[model samples]
Target: MFQETPQDALVGTWTNSLGTVWAIKADGTFQVSLSKNHRVDVWGKYTVTGDEMTIQESHGSHTPKSCRGKAIYKFMRDGEMLTFTKVSDKCKLREKNILAGWKPWKG
Candidate 1:
């Protein structure tokens, strides 16, 4: 039996410097914008244990090609800024950003 929701911290908008935006919701859904006026809507589920979180992209993008997959990440924040660092090499949404880390966004 579960008591209350988990990993509520991840439920919000996250963005990178490369114009990519991720809208993660608590209802097991996530949206990623790959470019201007272009976005990929997919399903996302996460498992949190201690300080580690695993994001599983259950469904890939609607586009023919996408970097959607499972990846392990660590959450960090500096004031209002939240970031995710890829601890696993499985996700390739943005190779450079993954290496450089992500930044939070409002839109």
Candidate 2:
């Protein structure tokens, strides 16, 4: 039996109640998009250590100037559901969006 790694558990597409989709890849990269229009809101790289995730946005739709900084979050996964708690983040918008929680995206 193959045991899933921490990265493996996080690698997939998840959607929030706000109709936003977050896709986390195996390459340490991630993208956030809107489900309605499929417009990418942000794209970035992330590193995970245990339950902690650090995200550094490479590009985004809003406040591009302020989005370059790294944001740290603590996340928990329960089956198909995933939730995040802020550890340290200077960007309020990013923090708000991430705290919304997510579930596996069937799409």
Candidate 3:
């Protein structure tokens, strides 16, 4: 049987208004797919400590290798909704995506 951790509640697929699909896994990794085509746009690792999440982009189709920076945000999960408030993020593109927020993906 699979045991659930504190982060397990967040282990699932989430989507934003811009058709971005964010998949957070139990293995401390995440992937982002922009648009309905579902081609992975970004891949990275994330760590959650309490209500805060720190994300570092490892690779992306549109992200440069030199742009690997860690972004920290305070996250809140209210039922089916998930939102982020930036704590510190030097990467503008990444900050934009995080601020956009997400909801549980039904599909």
Best by lDDT: 2
Q: What tens-digit string does per-residue lDDT give for candidate 2 at 6-105?
A: 7777889998888888899999999888547778878989999988989966587654566679888988889888999999988877777789989998
Q: Which ten residues in a row have the lowest lDDT in candidate 1?
A: 58-67
Where model 3 places Cα greater than 4 Å from the true spot, the runs are 1-5, 65-67
Ranking of models by lDDT: 2, 3, 1
State the number of backbone clashes in model 3: 0
lDDT of 3 by residue, 1-107 (tens): 98656587678999988778899998999988876888888899989898888886668877754548788888888888888898998777777777886888887
lDDT of 3: 0.82
What's the lDDT for residue 48 in model 1?
73
Model 1, which residues run further than 4 Å from truth? Answer: 1-6, 41-43, 62-69, 98-101
lDDT by residue (1-107, candidate 1, tens digit) is: 85644366666777777777777787766766767675674456767765566766546554223445666777765665666666884445444554454566766
Instruction: Estimate candidate 1's alpha-carbon lDDT, on a 0 to 1 scale.
Output: 0.62
Model 1 vs. true fold: TM:
0.67
Off by over 4 Å in 2: none
- The candidate, 2 or 3, that scores higher on lDDT is 2
* Every model's TM-score: 0.67, 0.88, 0.86
TM-score of model 3 vs. true structure: 0.86
Residue pairs with backbone atoms closer than 3 Å in model 2 (clashes): none
